[model samples]
Structures are given as structure tokens and as C-alpha cells.
Target chain A: MSAFNAQRITAMQWLSRQLLNQDVAGRYFDPLIEPLNPRWALGRMIATVERIEDETHDTRTFVLRPPRRWRGFLAGQHVTLALDINGVRHHRTFSLACAPETWQREGLIRITIKRTPEGLVTPWMHKNLYRGGALEISEAFGNFLLPDVEAPLLYIAGGSGITPILSHLESLACREYTAPITLIYCIRSAQDQIGAQQLEQLQHKLPLLNCQIIRADQGEGQPPRLLQASDIDSIKNIQARHCYLCGPTGLMAVATTLLETRDVPEEQVFQTFFAPLTNPLTDTAGGAVTLMRSNRELTVDSGQSLLEAAESAGLSPRFGCRMGICHQCSCRKTTGTVVNRNTGHVSGPGEETIQLCVSVPQGPVSLDL
Target chain B: MKTLNETQLQRLETGLDAIREDVVSDLGERDARYIRRIIRLQRSLEVAGRILIPLSLTPVGFVAGTASLSLAKIIENMEIGHNVMHGQYDWMNDPALYSQDYEWDTACDSNSWRRTHNYEHHTYTNIIGKDRDYGYGLLRLSNDTPWRWRNLFQFADYVGLSVLFQWGVGLHELEYEKLLSGEISLRDKGGFLKEFFRKGGRQFFKDYVFFPLLTFPVAGKVLLGNLSANLARNLWASTIIFCGHFTEQAATFHEADCENESKGQWYYRQLTGSSNFTGGRWLHLLSGHLSYQIEHHLFPDIPAHRYPEMAPRVQALCKDLGIPYNTGSFGRQYATVVKRILRFSLPERLTRQAA
Candidate 1:
């Protein structure tokens, strides 16, 4: 009882400090500690797999019962699920699915995972989880949040990239903040959509959200139907607005290419690519040039980064700072000529020049790679 | 031209000529197409006051300045000299030049920068073999090269003096030219006598004595304007320059390592070669886009003012390219410099470098 009373006092004092805007995290944590250290916070799994939906062969959704005393996260925060597999520790990040209000009233949370080929964590998650299974979780982290910008928002997601968007939707639902939202969640097929029921629930509950799940594999849509470069044609008036992208690296690459083709300033392009980048410099904003010494090729692309196409074709090259400052990424043209978009610097000398680290591939450009 | 020593002047001209040639060749002759425009822009800003004085003649001055004390006569002595090089008069119909000074309300665009700043300095940054910013000794801003023996004393000299200049602006200037002459030049004797005192004198009285003492603060707003402007420029411009190449984190590449030199290599050298300071709006706006040193290095002509707008794209690109784009506020950048100094000074053999 005495310990309980002291705990109550400490909680109240902590609440007071929060209201007073004191540095709480710094007051407790070792400031010099390396960021990569395991961050373990005690969180209980209250509810488990209410139901499962097989969106594809490898993806599923599991509604969870969080601890009654557990605090909910703001929309868009990610929680790390820790699982002890054969006494070895493993953790995987999952986006929260429950609305903050649901945490208050229902004391529940939801998370979805999709199995990627050869990925250890997701494949295991798909096969083993059971109803009401306890899950250890880490504190919520990540900066994917809605800004105060009152402008109507457009969200683009590819594959499993919908996780954070789902969290954002739940948060908006909890806050009762009315803002128009358009989500173009691209999937391989109609059956590939993972959170259809939850999305339908959001669409029904909040009339302000618009969700469009593009099915590329079905081949039933109009031109640029597969979420290609022309998908951003409708956002011409969105000058100075924000763009949030989350998806497989290739999808992000395509989306970025589409945005750049529309002449959207590089500043407005918000992208996050979560897959392996076969060619890291695909859709560059600009830096270091790639040069082709002998092959018959052309290099100039306002659409996709020049370096990306080359690397995509399995060319090994050396480059850096695709943003444009570092010359380490420079290449030389033993024969052809190229132009730089950033400083308007061009150096195609058919003899020895370089490809900018960031310039997207335009035509059939040759490279020394 | 007569005022400068024959041989010394020739060397300076030769140095600049070679740099210009590299700029044209390295950048793919794009400057060839835009050379006329850049030159015109440079000339106009150089004679700004001469023409402006005819229109508004009053002791109605006091605008804050952007020049730095460590930079020597940057405001007092070298203002007009740089103006002559930059061409501020081009602002008549040009919004680009006007926006260059937009961050600091008291500041105005002057010409010296188009050639001296925007073109040469930015494209070249501070590679000792190529960049003018690379002075001898510890005057190094980049770490791509290893420290030479001579730099041992120079480093001590710079740290001591640079720290002092960071405190007292005026006192630092009077002594800076002599101090810099030792390492940055093959022949250090000329700039102090001919270039600094005489050349610096002509521009000083016109900018400081005539502009500040005679014409400024007269309208009260002008005085407030000049002081604020000067303060803004000093804090913004100097801090930006410092963050980009001066911080201890910037590279000091060796003459040998710069092999297989190409434009992209140069770009990477400059991009990874500089440091970014973590600071406030005063630091961000006044210092140009230096807070985004990594971004600016990746895209020099994008304008320092536009860097904030480019941060996301830069971040995304850095991610896509798998390169580390270093940045932080002033405090963070400073802390980085402290760490850099420690690492740079450590005995080399004790360190196990990566293969």
C-alpha cells in the first residue's frame, strides 16, 4: 500500500512535469548512450488476433487487445513488437491500427504484417501468431505525422506501405479533426488489399477521407493506371504542398518519377523507399554525373534519374552525393555530352566527363559503368 | 592594375584563369552559354552605391552588414572590391540578385559575389590544390587530405585567431591579412601592402566611412537598418561559410588522393567534404543555406535561400543513394567540429582505418 501510494505520487509528478514542459526523456536516459541499443519498454498485449484476413498469400491482419492501462499512440507512430523465438530476441516494426479513442474505450490495438520473400521476421509472424497471444512491444517511434498545413492532403502508398497510412487514418478518426484526405494505395490486385474492412470502416465513419486502391496486376484501369509517372497529373495546383510516400523502393521510385515529370519542385517530394535499391541513384534530385566512354547511348532524363536506369540494367558504378555537391559521384563521357540541371553545369566531352549522382536516366544513354 | 606587384598580380590572375577554365570544362561548358549573363550581373552589382548615391543622398544610413571579421575587410575593406566582381547593378530587372540579400533586411546584393562567390568559390570550395579557400598550415577546412607538417603551426595560429575573430570583429580584421598571407599564398607579401591596405582602403571609406559615418543613421531608421543588416549579414553569411567548409569536420584531402579527378569526384569531395551547423532561424536565414551544407554541396547553384525548401528532397536522395548526408544545428555542428579536431589531432598510427 505504501509503495502503491509512492507510485501514485510519482505518476502525478510526472504528469505535472509533462504539463510544465520539462525534459523528461533526457532526465532519465543516458544521453551518451548509442542510439542502436535495444530499447525495451514494458508493454502488455491485452487482446490477440480477433480475426485474420488473407489479403495475399503472405499478408494478414490481427486485431490486438492492448493492456487496459496501456497508453495509445498518436496516429502514424510505429511500435516495435518483440518476440522471443527459441530464447533468441527478435523485433519487427508494425504500424498501430487502432484509433486512439479505441484505446481509451475498447483498450485494443491492431497491427498487420506481410511476409516478404526470404524475410525472416514477417514470414514467421504470418504462420505462428494465435488468438489472444501476448506480444511484447517497444515505445512508439517515427516522424510520420500530419503537419498543421490545412491544405487538402494526398497520400500515395505501394504494397505494405499502407501500414502507416492506416495509423494516420485511425488518428484522424480519434481526433475528430475534419480535413480532406485522398489516399491512392496501389496494390497488385483487388485481392492484394490488406486492410479493406478497416478502410471501409474509416470511409464510413469519416466522410472526409477518400481511399483509392489501384490494382496494377488486374489490368482493368485507364492509361497510367498502374500508378506510373502520370498519376500525379491531377495535383498541379498543389504547389508548396506536402507529399508523403511509403512503399517498396521500386514503387517509390516510380511515384517520384511521376512527380518530377509534373515539374513538382524537388522540395515538395516526400519519399520513403523500404525495399532493396538495386540502383540507389534512380530518381535523383541531382549530383555527380555518369559517363559512357564507348557504348552507343544517350543520357538525359527529366523523368527518372539517369543513374537509376543504368544500375537497373545491372551495371556496377561508383558515385556519391546524388544531391550534387560531391564529385566522388562524377563520371566522364569519352564521346558524348551531358548537361547538369542544378547549376546548369554540363560536361559531356565524348572524351572524359561524368554523370551527376542524382540525374535520372533519360534516353538510351551510354555509361562507362 | 598598376597598383599591384607585376609578378604577384600575374600569379593571382593566372590562378583565377586556370580556375575559370576548369569551371567551363568541368561543368560541360554550360557557363559558355550563360557567361554573358553572369558577367553582366557581376558588373552591375559592383557599382551599386555610385549609382544609388545619385538617387538617395542622405545621412540616412545604418543597415546591418553580412561581412565577417575573419574574412578581412569583407565589409569595411573588401565590400566594393567584391561588389565590382559581383555586379549588383544587374538587380535593376533581376530578382535573383535581390533575393540573395532577402534574408537580411538591411543587406543589399553587391556584385563581387557572382564571380568571387557564386561562381568561383562555390564551384571550387576548398581543395588545397584547386580551391582558394585552402590556405597553408592548419588553415584547412577540408579533411580529404592529411595534415602537412607546416600546418602544425598554422593550425594553432588559425584556432587561436579564428576564436578571437569569433569574438571581436574589428580587431580581428586589422591583423587578418598578415596572418593569412603566410600559408594560402605562394607569395604572401603582396595582398597586405597592395591588395589589402590600398585596395581595401579605397573600398573601406566608401562603404564604412562615407556610407556609415556620413550618410547612415541620419533617418534613424537607416542607422537601425544598417546596424541590423550588418549584424544579420555577419551572423548569417559568416556562419554559413564557416559551416560549409571551415568547421573542423570539413575534409583536408591530400594532393595524392585527388587522383582520377572528375566533376563528380569534385562534387562528392565538396559534398562530403563540408560540415553543417545546427542553429536557429538567425543562423539559418542569415547564414544562407549553409545549415544544409550537405544539400548545398550536392546542389550549389540552387541558392542557399532555397536549401530549406530542398531539405526533404536532399534527405530522400541521400537515402536513395546510400550516402550519409551530415547536418545539424549550430550547436550540433560545433560539437562535431570539437570531435573533428580531437580526431584530426590524434596520432595517426594509433588509429585503425577501414580498408
Candidate 2:
């Protein structure tokens, strides 16, 4: 990060914006530049895979060298990785499993991915992506991050959820933070436990760090043991410790309830869900919809999709295959919740692209149209 | 071919729907891989062309550079731009391939192309006064339109349209007929004209000014090379497009006859209004898989590469349903297109009607 290099990057950024004013420069230049170096692009943030390590049978850690323009992230933040498998680019988000100091020192970040057997992108990455492959990645995002105060902490991680927790622990160790930290790492089996070496290293570095590996599977014919009230009550001064949970939805729910019963403040308990929750189909009725572009408003029933609502209001949003097979009708939902009728997935109450054909408004919604 | 009854048309609808469902469900890595590979190949050819064009000191360099650049432009326009803008790969959700976001190397802006070609033409295929794509309101492809004094010289018009096909398409949305008839004023088209100039102007400057000026020492050679390449792409794209729709066997419908059409009837109309040219893989790729124009008209959002596999199933279903499946060798189809253009250029009574 020399002054000269910083100045050069600033100049390049300005030039890129000017050239991409209408995407005319990207349209012409990207093709030529990509063939020479896939990591170089005006519009996209490209990263090259510097190293790959197997952490478990289904999990691997990818060390990536992000392009020069990447603003480094906090320890627990995640990024969306866009992998071109076969011919299609598939996007999946994963937490950055490294401390920010690592990136600052080595210009590298790591993402630990666990392959889902039936998944599309992870399996392809496991089999096809080599050491030198390039991937498109979004800038680091997510609210699950380490707190600034040196407060006692409790971390509950299930299976691959250890990724972000590991990052937090390493960051604490890097800064020589001596606050009492308790990590209850849960896995289905011993073989499933990831970042074992890192946890051991963190335990040595931070003397007060208490690491607990909990295996849910007890033995033959026994039901799996999940997070219990005892798990939280056993932690020293449970009410005082700031609890951070990342795991299966059921486990997170149980942990939250247990902490709530112990009089832990709601703001003190932070959690992130790894799996997409299936939205309940109820409550998707009689919502006011606003088309932001045309300044049109209408009320829609549960059965009517946003596409139908827009069409009924005489707004001709581009659409094809009204069944939601084609994504031509996708537009940015600027505010409020909408449920995807096709998959029953509820969208976050932030700006995100949703297919108008199949998305039913769960509440008052504003669309980019 | 005999016209299909209502029951037969329903069967046609079910059969084609099944074919489309199969391809749509099966679209994954393979289809994605195919498009990306084609894009890579196209970009590689373009890079080679741009570098070689300036080194046009030798005759071989000039010819090869022009040919490569022309091929690259053809692939970008026809295979990538046209098909992507049709929302074919919109399912992938890749920003580069997204229909609404993709602007092409061609003069025709993507948004206008989607409106005029995808919405209007595909929705109202060959319905004489409805689908402007029938003859682009230029050539007399069918006797459905009254023969005018200008019909005698439409062959020349066709040639001129082919030579400047990109510009012609760029201006297609302006609807010159409406402006001339005083139905719509040029003032109403101020926004469209501005967009057309912005997109078309960028393309003009890139080929005529920017690239030529970049190769300052051999500026004239680069300028002529780009011009030749654009001409080659224009002629090739226009010819392939003509073979798809204006061929002798392709049928035309009336707007009155197309009112409140059912899905089955819509499928039937698409079948009759389009023609396909048989060729090798290269020809099909070069044509942007428009060689399966019937399938394209029916399923405009399906990946064009998948059209090759879908074509035979569609043809078989059409055959069983007693619907006409218009297809022939490339040479035969192009010849029929030429014949249709020349024959309709004369008065209907003077030239024999195509059966």
C-alpha cells in the first residue's frame, strides 16, 4: 500500500468509471484483458486461488489472493463466490475463515467450504477447481462480526459453522486480547470437526480461551444430542458473556431460547443461519405494493404474484414464462419482504432482485420496476 | 400440408410443451459450459483480429484479419447478443448474460431489440401488418401487402438493407412508416432517437474512429479493415435471418385471423411462419442457432444451443400433427429466400404464387 500504488489505483478507478459510464469500455476491454489475466476486470472483483487444503472429507479451505482493489474485511464477514462450473456461473456465500491481519500481511483470505452432496456449486468446486483457477467474488458483507469491547464471549458453532468463530478467535489471539472466551464447537462426529488445528493454536495463544468440542452422536441406536439448557448454564457467568451463535436453525433457536431464559439481553445474543429457511406460506395476503419506477401502488391478495399485480396496474415490466421459469421478470425489491412462490424462500427486507412472476409480497413492498 | 384441427393443435401444444420442459429442466453445467466456451472463442478471435488488422502491411494479414474480425462480430451479434437478448440465458442470472443488462457490439441497442424482436415479432409471427419483422416493412415477401410502384425495386432495397443491416435494425424501433404517415411525430421519438444515436454512435466511433486512430501508423488500413469486417458480418447476419423467415415455404397470417389465439394456435402459427436451414454445427453456431427458427420462435427463452436437440423432436411432433415443418439445405433455403424476394418484387399476377 505505497503512496505511488495507491495513487495508481485511484487513477485506474477513475478511468474505469469514465470508461464504464455506459459499459462501452467494459464491453470492448474486458474480453481482451480477461484472456490475458482473468483476475483483472473493470466491473467485477476477481480473485485467484493461491492454495487449497483439505480440512475434512467433505470440507476444504481455499486460500485466495484478491485483486488489488479489494478492501479487506473484518474477521467474521462473508463473501459471495461466483464459480463458473461447466459453463454457468453459480454464486454461493461463505464466511471468510481468516483474521483480517492475515489479509493485511499476506494479501490473502481463506474460505472454508463444506461440500453438500446434492448441491450444484460446492461439488463442482471440490472436483474441478484447481490451485490456479480464478473466481469472481463480492466484497465482504454480513453483520456477524466481532464486538469492539473486551467483553467475555461465548461462541456456539455447529458443524461447518466453526468457520466464522475460528476467524473471531484468531483475530482475538492476534490482538493479544485476554478476555475470557468460551467456544462450544458441536459436530455430528469427530471426523466432521473442522479447524481443529486452528482452535488448538488459538487456545495456546489466548490463555483464557476455553475450547470445547461436542459430538452430537453418542453411540449406536441413540438419538442425537443437540444444544441443551445445560450447555449455556454451564458457561461461567452465562448472563454476563456476549453469546455468538452460528449453526443449524434448530440449534440456533434452542440456544437463543436458553440464553433468553437465563436473562441474557436480546442484543447480546447474535446469530447467523447457514441454511436458507423455508418461509411459511401464510401472511402473504392483502399487502400494498409500490412500483418505485412508475410511482404506482396497488393492493394484492396472496394468490396474485407481483407480475400479475404490476400488469393489472398497467405497468409493463419485462417478463417471460409467467410460471417463473425464466428470470426475465426479475427486478429489485427495494423494501419489505416477498416470498418466492416457486421455492417458498422469504427474501430479506433489503434491496435484492426477485422474479416478479413467482414472488408474492408478504408485506408492504417497493419494487424498482 | 393440411391444416390441423382443434384436437390436433392441442396435441401439438402438449408435445412442444413437453419438449421445452425437458430441455429447461436439464439445463445446467453442460449448457452453461457451451455458451461460455463460445464466448471465449469469440473473444479470442476478436483479440487476434484487432492485433492483426493494424499489421495489414501484407495482403495475407489484411485478408485474415478482416475475416477473423468478421467472424468474431458475427458470433458476438448473432450467437451471443441476439440469443442472450432474447432472455435465453437469463436463467443463469449471470450479469454478463442477463438480457436486460447486456448491451451488444452491434448498433441495435439491447432494450429496443428485446421490445421489437422478442415481444412484437415473436408474439405476432408473420401476421402481415403486425410483425414488422415479416419483411422489416421494406421488402414485399408476401402478396398480403398490396403491390406498390416501389415493389419493382425492392430487390435493390433488400441488398442495401443487408449491407447496412445493423443500422437498419438499430433504427427499426423508430417505426418510419408511422412517422411518414403522420401517425406519430418525430418529437414523440426524441428519447428513442437519443438512445439509438448513443448506441449506434459508440459503435460508429469504435470501428471508424477509435480503433483506426489507435493504429495511427496504419490508420487507413485499420479503418478499411474494420469497415470490411462490419460489412461481412452485416451481410452474413442478414442472409441467415432472411433464410429463416422470408423463404418461399414460410407462411404469413393476417391480424384479423390471429385474434384471441390459443396457445395451440400460437404454436401452430410459429410453426408455419418460420423456416429452418439444415447445416453442420459451425453453420448452426454461426447462425446463432436461428437455423432452427421454428423452435426459436416457439421457445425464445431456451438456450439456442439446445435448439439443435429440440429441433428433431419439434419436427417429429409437427409431422404427426399434420403441421408444415419448413426446412431444407442452407443453399436451398437461401435460394428460395432470393426467389421469394425477386418474385414478390413484380406484380402478383405477373409472377406465379408460391404453393
Candidate 3:
């Protein structure tokens, strides 16, 4: 660690200790630096929802005010929001749908979320969230922003992937940035498009912006072109402009292939997938599994991670991060074929360690629990 | 240590039940706010205290700096570190305040402390053989502990323990007794020893070397000031903690007696096993709110600030139920604790008649 950082840490520790002391400052600020929390660690920042606005039928934008210690975020960075359901903490990552300028001016941050049918966090958020509700948020992170570039921009967004793109656009519009920009927003239906109103307003506000709507649903009038290579051919001067892609798995896959075929330089194409980019596993019907050392046999439900199945079977497996970041939950898969949800790699049947939090059993598997 | 009849025991159980229900319901934002505030004050005091210690050229600067640093250390260990490590503020959902992860600014490793103090001491409070904290495997605090010849030096041992209480706490989990007896091996203690030295080394460097070295011109005086401040904190912590369990009237139990213990019966044991010291708010902060030790034992996870409010209600119930509520002034309790230590140092046969 740098000397400056070490000194700062020591100072912060001392300051937190003073705040934790039995003085008026400690009393009034106790809710923030609770005695049970260590001062030196980067714990979750608590944010209270100031307001909520419906962006679409299934998507809502939540405006939150974080604690005083929260450092400002970049325009297109994503933050992980956490909530507890049935005594378990669940986390979901969403891009900052509001511009950084808005945060600086109003001390407000926003995340626009679209509900997914099988998503536990989003469905719960939609059903339960209200004004003034509190949620835990991580520091804004991710490198999905418009880098310092002189070229024109080609932004392609599908479904709720529009959140971060909208943040960039809003930031650009706020600056009245002169570089020409084009946005091709593809959605299942026109009504399902997120930030539709904001896009309309931005066209008038940012004179250099060119917005295009592509509805790929079967009932749409424009022959329902589902983002094929032909769509790439339709955009004029696609090679010269810097391209950015973010969306559902299908759109991203087709867009990526189309871009690759058109020979757009790899560095010029910046893509960030909000949804999983891992290859789809055809066999998700996980069957009965055996824990060799523990002498326990349990059924693994289709599509359930090994950790979840183990927990359901009255077994506690040590875990941390749960996002495959901290390898605390890695365990020996003595004999089994399991698919890694994060990397999409199928593990061979042998004695090898795998992260239980993100590894799904393909069939009857034996794990050295 | 008077034995109670069945009717009296039942009344005691009923009284404890009422107190628990009342306090459990009273847990709310107010209690949450109280702990949060204490943590803030502790941080501020610590920062200010550490910053002041280097400028100890003048007599007043030295005295004031040492006092501030000592006070900061005292509150950090007692109020913030001890209580928070007990899972007291885990309900807050603030990760920084999580009991499971909080590492205090002491020589003792947090994970080791949880093993020795949280899981062992709290779960088996005052149990003669099971709880290592029952006299910390040194002085025999009660008659239930068999007298040993080595215990005859407890008076001197107490003084050493006081001057270096953090070191003692750091080595609490070493189980050197087991190692010496051939029950465990050096290989077994390797991990623990490594962790101990790592934490203890950092503490030694900060207090003895780093800050003192910074005051190169007046190094001797500043070093002495830091040493004096640490010694003061150590003496204070040992005194308060020792008084909590070793006061004259506190009871110790046989592990057999605790089998299938009911909630009420468990509460009764905690009430009898731990003693409290009475003092003002400042005293409470310095003691880490351990002045209400009985209340703390009963509700280990509850914020310590709530104990004062709980004490009066608990005391009234104890009165109505005819149960003993062991408490007194700090001096009185400390004296009784010394007497217990000295008395227990001798064989039971000699002291039995007086008892």
C-alpha cells in the first residue's frame, strides 16, 4: 500500500473510532458507522429510495440517496443492489440510468430495472419496492462508458440494456456534445422500450443525435427483422463510427457476429451485456446427487446451482461473494459433469474443484462435500 | 451462593421470562441509533487521541495526550470491540457493523476471540471446567475450581495480568497447558501461533515503535507516554472484566447442572454467574457497559447501551422474585474480587469454615 493510503486508512480508523466514541457526533452518526461494523472495511453503502418512476410496463427507475460517504459515480457504471428475502441476501447489478451530472446537482442516483420472468431479485423489487424503501448498494463500478474518442458513436441497445446507454446519452446531451451519435434501440415491442420518452426528449435537446426504433416482435409492421446481418448493412458509415452493443443474449450474439463479419476493428467495438453472456446449456435437468464424504444423497432441481441444492438438502456449505469472485465456496466435484454458469465451461468427470455457487450439475453427480 | 427451594426457583424463572419479553420487544431504531452513535464517538476519540500523543513536549500536553489516548483505547476495547464482537449489532444489516466480520484494534485476533469468548465463554458462562474465561485458567475464582499449588502466586499473577491484559487475551487461545501436557502438538498450534504473532506484532510496532520513532527528538518521553497509556488501558480493562465474574457473590456452576436447561433456568444462571458495577454514564462507557454484566450475559446480542434501562426493570423483578442481583460500586466489587482471588489461592479445607 502507498504511504498516503496507509496514513489515510489510519486517519479513517481514528475518525471512525471518534465517531464511535460516546460523544454527540458518535450519537447522531451512529446509524451510519454502527459499532458492529469495522471502520476500515468497504462495507455496503445504504441508500434510501427517494422516488420511483415507471419507464415501461415491466421496468421502473428508482432514485436513491446514498449515505454521505458515498463517492460520486461515473456516468455508465453499474452498481450491485442487495436485498434480503427469506433471510438470504440477494444481489442484482444494474447500470446507473441517471447521468453523473444529476447526481452531482441533486445528490440523487438512479437504476432503471426491467423485470425478468425467472429473476428472483427483479420480480421481488417490482412487487415490493415503494418510495422511501431502503436498499444496500455497492460503489459504482464497470468500464462501459464512452471513452475519450473523436469518432462518431453508434450505440445499439436492446431491452433493458438501454439503461447505461441512456446514461451516456444524457451525459452527452447535458454537455451539448457536438459529435454526431446514432442509437438503434431494438425491443420486442415498441411499448416495451425503456427510456422511450427520454430518447424523444434527447433528440430535440441533442441536435447531433439520431435515434432509430427497431421493434422485432412478430406483430410489428417492419417485417420483424430480428437483428440479422442485413440490419448491419442498413446502417450507413458503420465502419467509421465507434460501435457499442448491450442487450439480451440473442441480440448481442447476432450483433457481435454481424460486426465481426463486417471487419470492424475489435478495439472500436465496445460491448457490455447486462444479461448472461455465457453459452446456453441445453441440459439443465439436474438429477439426484450424492455427497460422498458426508454420505448424503439429494435431488438437484433443474437449473439450480449446486450450492442452492445442497442448502435445500439441509447442508451448509461455506461461501462468500457468491458471484464466483471469492472462491470460498469451491468444493471438490469427485465425479460429475457440471456446467460453470459464469464461464459456460463443462467440467469433465474427474476429481476437480468447482465453485458450488455458480456450478450447475448436468446429471447425477458426486461431490466430496 | 445460597441454594433456592423449588418455589423460589420457579418465581425466579417467571420473573426472568417477563424481563426477556419486554426487552426483546423494545429492540428498535432507538437501540440501533444508540450503538451507531457510540461507534462514531469512539472513532473520533481514537483519531484525536493518536494525533495528540506525538506533541507531548509540555507536561500538560503529555498528560492530556496520554489521557485522551487511554480513554480512546478503553472505549474501543470495552464498549465498541467487546460488545460488537458479541453479535450485538448484526441485526443492523450494515456490513461494517456486522458482528461476524468486525476486527477490533487489539492484539487478540478476532476469529480466535470468537472461538474463546463468544462461543466458549458466553455459551458456558461461569461453568467451572468448560469455560476457559472462568479465571482465564489461572486464578481459582470459586470453590468449584479445585485448589492448585501454583495458584498460591495469584496475587502477583493478577498484577502481571493487569499490566499486560491485551497480551494475556492474545495468548488466551494458545492452550499452552494442553501442549505442555502432551494433549496437543506444536504442529497443531502452528496456525494459531502464526496468527497470534502477526496480530501481536502489529500492535507492538504501533504502540512501542512506530509512533515513538516518529518523535525522534523526544523519543524517550513520547515512548514512555504511549507505554503508560497502554498500561492504563490494560489495568482498567482487567479490573472491569475481573470484577464482572469474580466478585464475592457471583456463582459458578457444574456443567452437569446445565443439561437441557430451559430459557428461564439459563437466564437464572446468567443472573447469578455475573456481577455488575454501578456508575454514571462516563463510567458505563469506560467499562464498555459491562457495569451491567448480568444484563449483558442474559442478552449478549443486544446493544450494551440498552442494559442500563434494562437493569432497573431486571432489578425490580429480582426483588419481587427473591433472586439475588449481584451488583455494587466499582471499588467495592473490585475489592471483593481481590478477596475472592486471594481466598481461593489457599486450599478449600482451610477457607471452608470461614465461608
Best by DockQ: 2
lDDT (tens digit, per residue) of candidate 3 on A1-369: 699998886776654443332212333344445434422123446787889999888889998887778887877888877776533455667889888998888989878988887877788898888887777777788888776866788888988889899899888878878878888889888789888788888898889888878888777355775766666687777778788888877787788788878888888887776554254344676867899755789988777788888888855565545666445568888887988877778889898999988888888889887
Could you give candidate 2's per-residue lDDT for residues A135-166 as a string of tens digits?
88888878888888889999999988889888
What are the per-residue Cα lDDT tens digits for candidate 1 across B257-285? Answer: 45765554554566567776666754454
lDDT per residue for candidate 1 within A182-253, as digits (tens), equals 788998777778788889988987798877778877565544457854456655465544567888876787
| Span of ten consecutive residues with least summed lDDT in model 1 chain A | A27-36
For model 2 chain A, give the 10-residue run with minimal summed lDDT. Answer: A15-24
Q: Would you give me the overall lDDT of model 1?
A: 0.50
Write model 3 residue lDDT over B1-355, tens digit each, in one string.
Answer: 3446667677777776677678766666676667657766766766666667676557887788788788878887899889887867655544555565677767888879988898789889988888889888777887787888888998999999899999999999987667788988889988899989877876777777776777777777768877888899999999999989989999889888888876667788898999999988899988989999999998787788888888998898888777789999999999999898899899999899868
**Interface root-mean-square deviation for each candidate?**
25.3, 5.7, 7.8
Candidate 3: CAPRI quality band: incorrect
Per-model lDDT: 0.50, 0.84, 0.79
Give the chain B TM-score for each candidate: 0.51, 0.98, 0.93
RMSD, every candidate, angstroms: 23.2, 5.4, 8.3
TM-score leader: 2
Tell me the spans in candidate 3 whose CA falls farther than 4 Å from its real position: A1-77, A81-92, A98-161, A167-198, A201-369, B1-33, B179-187, B259-265, B312-322
Ranking by lDDT: 2, 3, 1
For model 1, what is the error of residue A231's alpha carbon versus the real structure, in angstroms, after optimal superposition?
2.3
Give the per-residue lDDT of model 2 (tens digit) for B1-355: 2357889988988998999999988988887777878887888888789999998678998899999999999999989989988878876757778776777788887778888888899888898888999888888888788899998999899999999999999999999988988999999999899989978887888888878888898999999999999999999999999998899889889887889888988998989989999999999999999999999999988999999899989988977877789999999999999999989988878875444
